[model samples]
Target: MKVIIAEKPSVAKNIADALKIKSKKDGYFEGEGYFITWAFGHLLQLYDAKDYDSKMARWKMENFPFIPEQFQYKVKSDPRNRDRQDGGAAKQLRTIKSLIKKREVDGIISACDFDREGQIIGDTIIENINAGKRVYRLLLNEWTPNAILQGLNQLKSNEELLPLRNAGVSRQWADWVIGINLTSAATLKFQKGKGQALNIGRVLLPTLKIIYDRDKEIENFKPEKFFKLAALFRTKDGKEYEGFYTEGKEDKFKTKEYLDNISGQLNGAPAIVDDKTTEKKRELPPYLFNLSNLQGYITSKYKGWTSSKVLKTAQSLYEKKYITYPRTASNVLDDSLTGKAAKVLEVMKKGLPFEEEVRFRKSKRVFNSAKVDSHSAIMPTYLVPKSLTRDEAIVYEAVKNRFIMQFMPAAEHEETKIITKLRNADMKGFFVSKGRVQLTEGWKKVENIKSKEALLPSVNVNDEVETVKNKVSSHETKPPKPHTEKTLLKVMETCGRSYNEEDTTAEAMEAVLSGFSIGTPATRAETIKKLTDTGYISALGKNLQCTDLGRRLVETFPVKELFDLEFTGRLEKSLADIEKQKFDKERFLQLIYQFTKEAVQQIKTGEDVIIHEIASSKRSTEVLGKCPVCGNGVIEGFKGFGCSNWKNGCKFVVWKNDKFLATLRKKPTKTMVKQLLTKGSANVKGLTSKKGNKFNAILKYEKNPENDYFSWKMEFDKKF
Candidate 1:
C-alpha cells in the first residue's frame, strides 16, 4: 500500500474519487491499496524567532539582526491565539505521519499542487515526521478524474524536486529574515505608538512604493488649458460627418483665441477631400486567460470585483474541474497539450451559436512550447460544470468563451481616413475624419460585441463638400487617473513597465518571462490584499490610493533599496534562477542575510523620526473627554479617539474596531468613549455574548497593570 498526501481536503477527496476509493477514515480516506490524507494548506511553518532562542522572545534593540544557525519547523500556531498550536493542523499532521509509518506502506506520493510552495508544504511535513519510505510526486494542473489518474500513473521521484525545494526554502528564509529584523527595527526606531507596526517585507515595500509614487504624481500634477477646432462637413449628397481640424499633425492649440479665429473662417466654407485612404485590418482574440490577465479583465469590467476575488473564483472552478490551473503565469498552452485542447474545444462548442465557426487548428499564437512555463494557460477542462454560483458562472463563462474564441476566425474590419481641406478659407490646415466598419464578426460573435465606430459619408478624393458648422472646444488637460486594481496588477506583473494588452510579440513575451515581476501571478493578488489589510493602501471605489501612513513611510523610510522596483525584481529573478538551478540557493540567501543586517543597522542608527504622526489639522479640536490614563484631553482622530498626550507615552486610546468590543458586536463610538472616560463606565446596549445572545451592559476600559495595555471589562445590572 502507498500513502498519498494532498494539499487540502477537497483535493484529497477528488483524488480518492478518481482512484475509486470509497472507504472513509478519520482525517483521510483508505482503500484500493492507498491511504489518502490531506493538509489544511500548510500543516507546518518555520519556527519563530523565540523558538530559536528564548532570549529573542521579547524584541529588544540589542538582539539586532538575529539569524538562526539552522531553521526548524513546528505545527502552525492558532490564528486567534498564537501561543498554542492549531488543533486541526496538529491532528492532521498526526494522521499523515501515522499513514506514512504504516507497515504495509512501501512508498509515499505527494499529491500537492505543482508549485514551489506546494513542494515545500509537503516536503516539510514529510521531513518533520522523519519518514524513510520512498517518495514520489504527482503533478497535475487540473483536478479532473482523467488528469489525476494519469498523474498517479506517471509520478516523479521526490529526488527530482531538489531545485524546487531549494527555491522555496530560499524564498521562505529570506522573507523571514528581512521581515522580522526590519519590521522590529523600524518599529523601534520610528513608530510612536502601539498596535501599528511598520510592516516591512521583500514584496510589500515595492508594491507599496508603486502606489505611493502614483499618489505623489497625482498630488503634484498641474493642469493646463487647451483648445481644438471641430467642423461639421456635408458631402454633395447631403451626408454629414464631423471632423477635427489639424495643423501639421497637431490638433490641440495652447490658446483658445487662435483656434477661435480659425473656427470663424471655416463656417459655410467650401471644402474638398484632399486625400482618402481605406485599409483592411484583422484583430486576433486576446491570449488565453493567465491568472493576472483574468484578474485584470474581471476586475476592470465588473463593479465591486477585486483581483483577489477573481482568483478565488477561478481557483474554485479549477478545483471543480471546470478549468485548468488558474494560478499559472504563462498565457499560452504547451505544444504537448494540443490533442487534449482540441478534444476540450470540440466538447465546448457543441451547442454554441458559433459552433460552425469554431474549428480547431494548430496556431503558434495559442500553443507554443517556448512560451509555456511549469503550467499552461488557464482554459476550461473537458468536464463542464452543470451548475455553479452566480459568481462562478461569471468567471466560468469568461474562461469558456475565451477558449472558444481562440479557435474561431480572426475579427476583420475596414478603417477609412479622410483629409478634407478648406478651399476658400485662408487657414493652412485640414480637417480629418476617421471611421471603422466591421467586415466580419468572426470571433467577436462569441461575445455579441458588435463593432461600434463612426460611419463616414461616401466621398472620394477631390470631392467638394460644405463645412456647415465649426466650433472651438476648450479643454483642460486632466491628470493621470489613479491606479485601479487591474492597472496596478499589470504594472506588478510587468515589473513597473507599461505594455499594451494587445501586444503579444515575442519581445513582449520575453519581458513577461524575464522573471523580473514584483510577484508571481499566484501571489500578486494576495500582496495587494495584504497592503489594504495592513492599512498601507486603501481602495476608494476601484482606485487604489496610498494612505497617509503609506505615503509617509515611502518618504521617510531610510532603506530606499527596499522601495526600489528594480531591486525587488532582481531578487525575484534570483529566486526564479534558483528554481532553474542556474543560481545557488546558498549564495542568494547569504546576500539576503547581508542586506537584512545592513537594513536593520541603518534603521537602528539613523536619525530618529516618527512615521505615524497625529494629523492635528484633521482631528477635531473640541475635546471629546479626558484621557483615562494621562488625564489629558481626548480628541477624535481619523481612526479613533485618542489622548492628546500620546507623545508622552500614554497609550490610552479607544480604537474604532477595538477587539474586545468587536467580540461583543460593538464598536466604541464618540458618545460611548466620552461617557466611559468621564464616568468610569458606559452603558452599552445590544452587546452580544459568545453564544450570540444580545443584552445591555456597562463597559469600562482600564489599563492592565501586568502588561500596561488596556483591557475592557463588562458589567451587567442583571443576568438573563
Candidate 2:
C-alpha cells in the first residue's frame, strides 16, 4: 500500500479520484493499494516564547530576547479551522506511522501545493513521522487531474528540496524573534494599562513605517508659492495649443519685473517653432498576474475587495484547478505553454471584450520561459466559473483575460513629435511638441485602447500658428495627502526593495528595479492587514493616518538602528542566501537574536524624549481661573490652559470660550465662569436665563482679551 498526503482535503479528494481510489474511509480514501489523507494547513508550528521558559510568560525586561536553543515543533490543531480538534493530526500521523512500521507502504508521496510554505509543511511532516520508507514528492503546480497525473510520473526524492526547508525554518525563526520581542517591549512601554498590543513583524513594521512616515510628511509640510505662464494658440485644424513659460535658468527671472521685461519682448511678437521628432513602437500585453499585482489591480479598479480577499479567492480557484497555482512570483508565461494559448483564448472568446481581441499568434513578450518560475501566473484551464463573488469574478476576469490576450499580436502605434523656434527680437530659442497615432490596436483591443485616451498629435517641424489666447496662472505648492491603500502598498514594495543590496546581476537588478516588492504574492495582503490591526496605524476613509503613539515610536527609535532601509535590504539578502544555501541557518538565527538584544537595550535605556502630542486639546499653557464647582483652587497649566482644580488630582478642565459663533448663531455664546461668578448665572443663547429661574438677564461683556467684565440686563424674550 502507498500513502499519499495532500495539503488540504479538497486536493486529497481530487488526487483520490485521479488515482482510482474509490473506497472512502472515515478520514481518508483507500483502495487499490493506496491511502490518501490530508493536513488542515499547518499540523505543526514552532514553540511559542512561553514554551521556552515560564519566565517569558509575563514579559519582563530581565528576561529579554528569549532565543530558544533548539527549535522544536509539536503536533497541534490548526488555529484557523476551529470546528474540530479530534486529534485528527495525531491520528493521521499514527496512520502513516502504522503504515511505515508495518512496511506495507512501499513509498510515501507528498502531493502538496508548489510553494515555499507547502514545501515546509510536507517536509516537516515527513521528518516528524520518521517515515523510514523511500520518500518522494510530486511537484503539483496546479490542481487539475492531468497536472496531478503528470506530476506523479515525475516524483522527485525529498532530499532534493533540503534548501527550501532551511529557508522556511529561517524565515519562521526570524519573524518570531523580531515580532515577539519588539511587540512586547512597545506594548509595555507605550500602552500603559490600556493593554493595546502593538504587533511588530519583519513585514509589518516596514508597512507601518511607510504610513507613519507619510503622515509626518503631511503634518510638517509647508506650502510653497509659484507661477506659470501659458501662451494659447489655435491651429488650422482647429486644435488648441497652450505654450508654457520656458525661460531657462540662465534667463534669471526671479521677479515680476524680470517676467515683465520678457513679456514686453513678446507682447505682439510672432512665436517661432523649433524641432519635431517621432518614433513608432508597440506595447505588448501586460505581464501576467502575480498575486500582489492582482490584489493591487483589483483594489484600485474595484474598491470593494482588499489584497487578502483576492488572495483567498485566488487560492480557492487554484485548489479547484480552475487556474494554475496562484502564488507564483513570475509574471511570465511558460514558453512550452505558448501552444496552449489558443485553447485559453478560445475559452475567452465567448466573453465580450476578449472575444473581439483574441488572436492565434503568440507575442514574444508574453511567452518568455525565462520569466516563468514554477507554473505560470494563474490562467483559466478552459473552465469558466459560473458562481463567483464579485471580487472573485473580477480577479478571474483579470487573470483569464491576460492569458487570452498574451497570444494576441502586439499593440501597434505611430508616435510623432514637432519642434519649432520661438524667436525674440534679439535671440532665438527652441520649443518641442509630440503625439501618437495608432496603426493597429492588436492586443490593445482586449482592453479597448480606442475609447481609452492616447496622447495628442504633433505638428510638422516648420508648422507655425498664431497665438490665439494666453494667460498666466499663479499656484501654491500643497502638502502631501495621507496614504491611501494604493499608495501604502507601493511604499511597502519600494521600502523593502530600498534595502536590497545584492550585486547588480541582471535578475537582482531587475528584482530591485521592478521595485515590484518583497513578501510573496500570497503574503503581502496579510502583511498590510496586520499593520492596521496593530495600533501603529488608524484608518480614515481609505487613507491610513498615523496616530501620536505610532509617530512617537518611529521618531523616538534610533533611525539608523531601527528604521534603516539598508538594514532591511541586508536582511532580505540574508533570507535569499538562506534559500540558496550560502549561509548557515543556525548562525543566521543567532545573528537575529544578537541584533534584537541590542535593539531592546536601546529601547529600554535610550533617553531620547518624544513629546507626545495631546489629541483634542491644542493649548500650550494654562492661566488662573476659579473652579466652577469648588470656588477655591485656581486652574494652572502650560499653553494658557489648565484644570479647574489646582491640587488633589481632580480632572476637571476648561477652555476660554471664543465668540465666533455669535454671527452664525445670531446669539451670544455664554461663558461657564460667568454662570458661576454672579449668582452662578450667565446669559446664554442671546435671550437670557438666570440660576434657579430667578431672573431673565443677558450678560454683556466689555470684550477684551484681558480686563473683560460683564453686566446683566434683565429682560424677557418679547421685551427685546
Candidate 3:
C-alpha cells in the first residue's frame, strides 16, 4: 500500500476520484493498493514565543529578543483548547502515521500543492511521524487527472526537495524571530504599561512604510503654476486641428506674459508647412498575465475588482480547466507545453473570431524553456469552460485573449509629424504637430487598445495652412498620485532591485536572482489586504491611502531598515537564492539573527515614544474630554476614540472608521469623538456624500440597550 498526502480534503477527494480509490475511511480513502489522506491546509505551525520559555508568556522587557537556540514546531491546535485536539489535526496525523507504519505500505507519496509552503507541510508531518518509509513527492500544479497522472509517473526523491523545504523553514523562522522579538520590544519599550500589542514583521513593516512615505509625500507637496502654448489651425476642408507648441524645456512658460508674447507672435504670420514626416510603426501585443500583472490589469480596468478577487477568479478558472495555473511568476510558457499547444489553442479559439489566425508555432517570445521555472505561465488548457459567471468570463477572456493575441500579427500604425514655420511682423518660430493612423488593427481586434492615436491629414512640406485660432493655457503641476492597486503591486513586485548600503551586499546578491520582489507574488495581495483590514491603510475607490494608524506606526518605529525597501528586496532575493540552492541557509539565519539583535538593542536604548494607546489601557495622558456615560477621560487610540475606563468594561468607544463616517472620508479623531461624548454631537464639515456632493452634518454617538457587542453607534444630523 502507498499512502498519498494531499494539502486539502477537497484536493485529496479529487485525487482519489481520479485514481479510482473510492473506499472511504474516517480520515482517508482506501483500496486499490493506495491510502490517501489530507491535511486541513497546514496542520502544524512554528512554536510560539511562550512555547520556548514560560517567561516569554508575560511579554516582559528582561526576556527581550527571545531568540530560541533551536526553533521548535507544534500542532496547529490552540494551546488553550489542547484537550479537543484529538478529533482534529491530531487524529488525521495518527491515521497517516498508522498507514505509513503499515507492513504492506511500500512508500509515502506527498500529494501536497507543489509550492514552498505545501512542501513544508509534507516535510513537517513526515519528520514528526518519523516513518522510515521511502518518501517521494507528487509535483502536481493543476488539479486535472492528466496533470496528476503525469506527476505520478515522475516522482522526485525527498532529498531533491529539501532545499525548498529549507528555504520555507528559513522564511518561517525569520518572520517568527522578528515578529516575536520586535513586537515585544516595541510594545514594552514604547507602549510601556499599555496592554496593546505592537505587531511587527519582516514584510509587513516594509509594506506599511511604502504607504506612509506616499502619504507624507502627498501631504508635503506644494503645487506649482506653469503655462503652455498651443496653436489651432484649419485644413483645406475647414476641419480644425490643435497642436501643442513644442520647444523642449522652453515649451513651459512660468509667466503668462511670456506665453501671451509667444502666442501673439504665431497667431497669423503666414505660416507654411515646413516638414511633414510619416513613419510606419508597429505595437506588439502585451505580455501575458502573471499574478501581479493580472492583479494590476484587472484592478485598473474593473473598479470594484481587487487583487484577491482576481487571484480567486483565476484559481477557479484553473480548477475548471478554462485556464492554466494562475499563481505563477513567469509570463511565458515552457517548452514542455509544446506537445499540447495545438489542442490548447483549438480549445481557446473555439468560439472566437480569431480562430483561423491563431496558428500554433514555436515562438521564442511565447514559449521558451529558459524563461520558465517549475511552473508555466497562465494560459488556456485543452478544456474550455462553457458556463462561467460574469466575472469569471471577464478574467477567462483576459487570460485566453492575451494568449490568443500572441499568435496574431503585431498592430500596425502610420505615425505622422507636421511642422509649420511663421516669420512676419509677429515674431518667428516653428510649431510641430503629430498623429498616428492605425493601418492594421491586428491584435487590437481582440485586445482593447482604447483608441489608436489620431490620424493627420496628408500635407506637403511647402503647403500653407491658415491659423484658425490659438491660445495660451495655464496649468498647475499635480501632486504625486496616491498608490492605486495597479501601481502599488508593480512597486511591491520590483522594489527589491534597490537598497541603501555602502558595501552594497544585498543588492549584489539580488542581481543574481531573476525577479526580486518585496513579497512573493502569491502573498503580496494578501499583505496589502491585511494592511487595509488592520487599519494600516484604506481604499478610496481604487486608490490605496495610508490611514492615521498606519502612518503613525511607520513614523514612530525606531529601526528604519526594518521598513526599508532595499532591505526587503535583498532579503527576498536571499530567499530566492535559497530556493535556487545557491545560498547557504545557515548563513542567512545568522544574518537574520544579527539584524534582529541590533534592532532590539536599538529599541531598548532609543527613546522614540510609542503612542499612548488607550486600547485595553487603565489610563492615558492623551485624553480628549470626559466620557458622557462613565465620566472618565475619553482617549485616542489606534483602533478607536475610547474612554479611559475601557479596562473596567466601559464600552463607550467610537471606532476610528465608524461605518457612519467611513463613506464620508472621516476617520473618528479624538476631537470628533470628544464632541460626541461631551456635547452629544460633533459638527463635521466637507463630508463627501455617496453622490460625491460635499456637505456638513452633526455626528452624534448613541448606545443601544439591546446588543452587547455592538452597543456604541454613531448617528448623523442629516439623513445622508
Candidate 4:
C-alpha cells in the first residue's frame, strides 16, 4: 500500500474519488491499496524568533539582526491565539505520521499542488515526520479525474524536486529574516506609539513603493492647457468625415489663439487628398490568462472586484476542475498539451454560434514549450462545469473564452489613414483622418466584442473636398489617474513598469521570462491585500492611493534598497535561478542575511526620525468615554476601543472582534462601545445563538476579578 498527501481536503477527496478509494477514515481516506490524506494549506510554518531563544521574545535593540544558525519548523499556531497550536493542523499531522509508519505502506506519494510552495509544504511535513519510505511526487495542473489518474501513474521520485524545495525554503527563510529584523528595528526606531507596526518584507516594501511613487506623481502633477484644430470635410458625393489639423507630426497647439486663427483660414477652403493608405492588420486575441493578467483583466473590467477576489475565485474554479492551475506565470500552453487542448476546444466549442471558427491548430503562439515554465497557462478542462457561482462563472468564462480564442482565427481589420491638405489656404499643416473597419470579427465572437467601424469615404490621391466646418477645441491636460488594483497588479508583475491592460500579457510574459518581478504570480494578490489590510494603502473606490503613513515611510525609511524595484527584482530572479539549479540556495540566503544585518544596523544607528505619530489631538477630540478600570479617556483605534492612558499600563480595552461577541455573531461597533462605556451595559440587538436563533439582549463587558481580563455578560429583558 502507498500513502498520498494533498494540499487541502477538497483535493484529497478528488484524488480519492479519482482512484476509487472510497473507504473514509479519520483525517484521510483509505482503500484500493492507498491511504490519502490532506493538509489545510500549510500544516507547518518556520519557527518565529522567540522560538529559537526565549530572550528574543521581546523587541529589544540589542537583539537586532538575530539570525538563527539552523532554521526550525513547528506546527502553525492558531490564528486567534498565538500561544496555542492549531488543533486541526496538529491532528492532521499526527494522522499523516501514523499512516506513513504503517507496515503495509511501502511508498509515499506527495499529491500537493505543483509549485515551489507546494513542494516545500509536503516536503517539510515528510521531513518533520522522518519518513523513510520511498517517496514520489504527483504533478497535475487540474484536479479532474483523468488528470489525477494520469499524474499518479507517472509519478516522479521526490528527489527530483529537491531544487524546487530548495528555492521554496530559501524564499521562506529570506522573508522571515527580512521581515522580522527590519519590521522590529524600524518599528522600534521610528514608530512613536503602540498598536501600529512598520511591516517590512522583501516583497512588501517594493510593492508599497510602486503605489507611493504613483501617488506622489499625481500630487505633483500640474495640468497644462492645449488646443487642437479639427475640420468637418464634405466630399463631392456629400460623404462627411472629421479630420484634425496637424503640423508635421504635431497636432496639439500650446495656444488656442493660434489654432483659432488657423481654423478661420480653413473655412470654405478646398482641400486636396495629399495621401491615403489602407493597410490590413490582424490582431490576435490576447495570450491565455496567466494569474497576473487574469487578475488584471477581471479587476479592471468589473466593479467592486479586487485582485485578491479574482485570485480566490480562480483558485476555486481550478480546484473544481473547471480550469487548469490558476497560479501559473506562463501565458502559453506547452507543446505536449496540444492533444489535450484540442480535445478541450472540441468540447467547449460545441453549441456555440462561432463553433466552426474555433478550429484547433498547434500554433506556436498558443503552444510553445520554450515559453512554458513549470505549468501551462490557465485553460478550462475538458469536463465542462454544469454550474458555477456568479464570480466563478465570470472567471470561468474568461478562461474558457480565452482558450477558445486561441483556436479561432485572428481578428482582421482594414486601417485607413487619410491626409488632406488645403489647396488654396495659407495653412502649413494638413488635416489627418484615420479610421478602422473590421474585416472579420474572428476570435472576438467569443466575447461578443463589437468592432466599431469608422468608415472613410472613397477618395483617390489629390481628390478635392470642401472644408465645411472648422473648430478649435481647448482642453486642459488631466493628471494621471490613481492606480487601480488592475494597474497596480500590472506594475508589480512587471517590477514597477506600467503597461496598458490590453498589452499586459505580452509585457508580463517578457518580465517573467527575464526573471524580474516584485512577487510571484501566486503572491502578488496577497501583497496587495496585505498593503490595504495593514493600512499602508487604501482604496478610493477602484483606485489605490498610498495612505499618509505609506508616504512617510517611503520618504523616511532609511533602507532605500528595500524600496528599489531593481533590487527586489534581482532577488526574485535569484530565487528563480535557485529553482533551476543555476544559483545556490545557501548563497542566496547568505546574501539576504547580510542585507538584513546591514538594514537593521541602519535603522538602529541612523538619525532618529519618527514616521508614524499617534495623533493625540485627534484622539482627544474623538474620545468615546472614560475607561471603567483606569478612569482614563477611551478612544477608538484601528483594532479596538482602548484607554488613552495605555502608556501607563492600563489594560482596559474592548477588541473589535472580541471572542465573546463573535460567538454572539456580533462585533463591537463604536455605538455599542460608547453605550457600554457610559452606561456600563449596551442594549444589543439580534445577537445569534449557537442554534441559529437570534434574540435581543443587554450586554456588559466586565473584568474577571481572578484574571483581570475582560469578559462579556448577557442580561435578558424581563419578558424573556
Worst 10 residues of 4 by lDDT: 613-622
lDDT of 4 by residue, 1-720 (tens): 999999999899999889887899899999888999999999999998999999998999899889999999999998756787888899999999999999999999998888989999999999999978899999899999999988988999999999999999999999999999999999999998877688988899898998888888889999999999889999999999999999989999998888888888887989899899999999899989889889988988887688889999998988888899999888889999999998998899999987788788888888999888778899999989888888999999999999998888889999999999988778788999999999999999999999988989999898899999988888899988888887887777778654665554555566777668888988999999889777798775578888898989999999999999999999998988999999999899989999998999899888898998765434334889999988889998777899888765688889875656766768888889899999999998988877788899999898887677988888999764
Ranking by TM-score: 4, 1, 3, 2
Clash count of each predicted structure = 0, 21, 1, 0
Question: Candidate 3: where are CA atoms >4 Å away?
Answer: 78-87, 192-196, 248-250, 319-321, 389-391, 425-428, 496-515, 615-691, 694-720
Candidate 1 residue-wise lDDT, 183-289, digit = tens: 98888888876665788889998999988888888999999998988899998888999899898989989998888888778878899999999999999998998
Clashing pairs in 1: none
- Cα lDDT tens digits, model 3, 174-245, are 988988899888878776445447777788888888877887899999989998878887766666666776
Better of 1 and 2 by lDDT: 1
Residue range 7-58, candidate 2, lDDT tens digits: 9998999898877778987667887777888877778777777777877878
Against the hidden reference, what TM-scores do the models get? Answer: 0.86, 0.74, 0.84, 0.87
For candidate 2, the per-residue lDDT at 685 reads: 42
Measured on C-alpha atoms, candidate 3 has an lDDT of 0.76
RMSD of 1: 9.4
